[model samples]
Target: MTPHNELRLLPWSGPDGKPCFLSTDNTNGHLSRLADNTEAIQLDLATELLDYASVLLNGAETDSEELRALATDLTEALRDTLRVAESRGHRLPPPHTDTHADDTDSPTLPAAAFG
Candidate 1:
């Protein structure tokens, strides 16, 4: 089990040694008693998709109302998905060995705005 400030990443290996991920943290304590971890992974994918959509919207030359609406929909969907995951006792994955982590247990984001 890997834990971040408020996020935790738990990787589970199947009988065949294949791997998958689970999230366990304050926001997802409800899922701690659940028997499966698929719900969390699904929510993570939805979040990732929303991230991509954010990038697309940010880089677009024309932020049409349709695009804005689509982005809003995706954001709302992501929020709902996260809520469900939490209700199911799951959470978003904690930062792994990725550069996102500051090589410490403290909170670290993608940038170093303040010390």
Candidate 2:
């Protein structure tokens, strides 16, 4: 187990396009460096997706196929973003509603919560 402050959680997609988290305490290690690189790429992709979504929302062609494609991309990007937030404990409910008493008792994310 890793202390919350020491662990660096990097969000990424597997080869099959599934969300995955790489945890590391060594911020300067080789794998950690890779995680940093991967995070950059994912962020870029997310930005591109957002730009496209804006275009669609602001009156683009309304073909069903095109809409479906954009919807799929949007879902993927949002899921990636949420996974990143979840790993950082940023999206949890308020403390009053939280069941866990401390950091050590935090609930684990289900595999399906990823891509």
For residue 60, what is the lDDT in candidate 1?
50
List, residue by residue over 2-91, the lDDT tens digit for candidate 2.
445544455765798765555555667898778657667777899999997788878855888888998998888887777666656732
Alpha-carbon TM-score of each model against the true structure:
0.32, 0.58
Cα lDDT tens digits, model 1, 1-115, are 4333333323333588654344444444654434245445656767787787778768857558868777787876665475555543534345455433446656555566755
Tell how far residue 107 is off in model 1, in angstroms.
Answer: 21
Which regions of candidate 2 deviate over 4 angstroms? Answer: 1-10, 13-23, 90-115
- Top candidate by TM-score: 2
RMSD of 2: 11.5
Give the clash count for each candidate.
2, 1
Q: Who wins the lDDT comparison?
A: 2
